[model samples]
Target: MPDADRALPAHPFDDDKLHEECGIFGVVGVQDAANFVALGLHALQHRGQEAGGIVSYDPDVGFNSARRFGYVRDNFTKASLMDSLPGQLAIGHVRYSTSGSKGQTAIRDVQPLFAEFSVGGCAIAHNGNLTNADSLKQELIERGSIFQSSSDTECIIHLMARSIQNNISERIKDALRRVEGAFSVVAMTRSKLIGVRDPRGVRPLMLGKLGDGWVLSSETCALDIIGAEFVREIEPGEMVICTAQGVESFHPFHPIKPRFCIFEYVYFSRPDSVIGGHSVYETRRRIGVELAKENPVEADLVCPVPDSGTPAAIGYSQESGIPYAMGIIRNQYMGRTFIEPTEQIRNMGVRLKLNVNRALIKGKRVILVDDSVVRGTTSRKIKDMILDAGAREVHFRIASPPTMWPCFYGVDTPEKDKLLASTMTEDEMRAHLGVDSLKFVSLDGLYRACGQKGGRDSADPQFCDACFSGDYPVKPTDMIDKGFKVKEPA
Candidate 1:
């Protein structure tokens, strides 16, 4: 377990935002495909840091695979490893645990989960969670399917294995039909690479092209890493199969109104990447502008919590006419505090990661802008740190609406009962954090920032705002059937 490598930090203030589930990358018709996959996975390392795996197919050797528990750079970047995985076709995955799963330390659970069928062999890598996996797994096991890994992704393989369809594409379609919730899947056969986005497009998958080759990745940044030209985003409810003969498209699922995850702009994606034809950085800046319009605060300066909050803080500063300052300096070497083990280590983790700039903040009324506050622990700790540094007043401006509901798609959010906003009012949250004021961007403002002209259209929502709004696009079948209650929105 990752917790065994280092003590899992027990601090309340550790990691108050949602965590993306995993990243997927695949390429076909590229010489030294594994190397390109390594670079692509490196670019996507931020999406998943716990483990990475790559599966490649060379006609001579058939299929080759390497799965390890650690950062992609530490595992996939070595020359020897890449050489061993040489092929014209490849797929890779970097993973954190699937949402709601725990104590999963087995490397077998890592991805590019492979299987051999009587028809032909293939490898699959998936981002996002399956809401109906448990029910499917139970049925499959009852029918005598021996499971290899505990990951929900393996359920796809099992379903594919039992599929009556002869063609690989048909089998994949059949498997997907049995599952529910968000998925952006990349798969490989010896002669082809395939990418599929679920009906609602709750997760992101983009198509790129390089020298007669096709690439598919969870983010556009991966395409940028390999000098691949952006082809287009794979459409919701769409599947693209790339082969030497060229590409073929299919829409096997019944169409629904697309609802891409809105939080991708609020946090998940790389700033440089484009989603829905808009730059993520620009979207975040626009979010800041919306927050400023919705909840303006008077203060001497606007400051960010660092890295994640930087762009929004700049936007807030510009719109609110508050000077933007880096009142805290981050220690680049320190890892995230959420992974720290003991409370003592957790308490020290923040100090080790960030230092207050006492001179700049002293006696200044500071406005701190951040993406969102889940548990409020991190916000409280930072508030104390700033006050101790002599800030006269602290106000918080959040770029997203209160994360009152837990995300069941792919993000690792706390259970609804544990989310601070789920249980507290704005006044209670401000008092708890010891801040003069706390304001979150309204849901409509967030939608407008995403380029929705008249704010959110409830009848045909533009994106998935389940974390902020109680309207989940897809029913969380497994969670609901298992008796896990979703708290009613306050």
Candidate 2:
């Protein structure tokens, strides 16, 4: 991804920026996998603007793939290129890495990776993390296995090859059991489109249908992009197979618990995307309502940071009876804007991709609603921008609770020290942002707003709370830090 739209600071100092996560999409039982993949990926662009790729499968020629580390448009703009990726079944991925995960940062680590064996060919796309991947990869490597990428997903591919089983479903089940993590996988084979969510359902995966098509997408938002009707989400702890023989469903390892990532409602998902029966919009709107109830602020108007902040801002405005306004105009064409690398740009940065509406911010005391504050660099710069824009006062309202921990399930966030909330108290965080007041949604408020904090057997009863609570279902070892080098013997 290009940093032209980036919050580039001329020098390093106090600045502001937020990190982004990636998105996943897939369409099977379709006539043109590439075209559908392109369309679906486009819809998911908001998930990860950094890189994109698609894999098309045809029995006659094997798997045909196209991958680019930039925006989807950068690679899939030509009609002929789409022609090159010919197949009726396809799965694709878009990516954003925070700073750690080596395999995740490399473009090659982008999804829809393919591996072939005597058993058959497999192309898989995944969203979320594998806690045990580092250990699993080390074990596989010790057994003389070679890895092409740093992704945990490669572990799954390698394990499937190692299984040597005749049954594909059994192979997937076996591989899934050995690994502990939060994954929602969409795997494509010569004859089938298989979808599986972790037994805990830490992430979102949905099943959809259009005409004679059976669609397996990371979220229902992709289904809307391809004119597919929303069917129910793939059940947690269950595997759903959509193939020519018809659809089959089974639960071999039921966890009896659900923990979908609360961030999906706060930041990761497109507000239009519905997961586990809760519309992202509804989830966010409820957050706003909850915010109004929890923190009543006196401001002239409720202004969201824009885009992701709009729905929650609207909810806040409606519930608080404050009119909502677009205080900052986003430069949509600002390319793939990334975290501002330095401080000078941070000091003077006023939205490399955002423009403050002087008319909106000039005189009124403004309340700014944003999702979360990462490095505090971006938030500080943005707050300073609002202050410089002539605002009477600036109050920052974060939709979710303070993110004190880094996400391991592939959110691409930076290390713990970089997380502003991780090192500061609410008062300290308030002092850093230079805002008149700083408030974040409480843990209870966030859970209640997202409709994710619920008991067992609830309709949408899955949530990934690993980041907030350090009970990672799986935690990789320091094979990277402690040096798990697979260099051959000299």
Provide TM-scores for the models.
0.95, 0.88
Error of 1 at 445 (Å): 0.4
lDDT on C-alpha atoms for all candidate structures: 0.87, 0.74
The C-alpha stretches of model 2 lying farther than 4 A from their native spots are 1-20, 98-107, 337-350, 452-462, 469-490
Error of 1 at 389 (Å): 1.0
Best candidate, TM-score-wise? 1
RMSD values for the candidates in order, in angstroms, are 2.4, 6.0
Model 2 residue 416 CA deviation (Å) reads: 2.1
What lDDT score goes with residue 419 in model 1? Answer: 97
Compared with the true structure, what per-residue lDDT tens digits does model 2 show for residues 136-169? 8889999989997777788888888888679677
Tens digits of per-residue lDDT, candidate 1, 1-490, equal: 4544332222233366677679999999989999899899999988987778999999999899999877787778788988899888999998877542443547778889888898899899999999998898999999999986778999999999999898788899999988999999999887989999999999999999989899999999999999999999999999999985688999999999999999999989999999999999999999899899889877999999988888899889989999999998887764443453576665574676788999999999999999999988778878999999999999999999998998889888888889999899989999988899999999999999999979998777899998988888889999899787764545
Q: Which stretches of candidate 1 lie over 4 Å from their true place?
A: 1-14, 335-344, 486-490
Let me know the TM-score candidate 1 reaches against the reference structure. 0.95
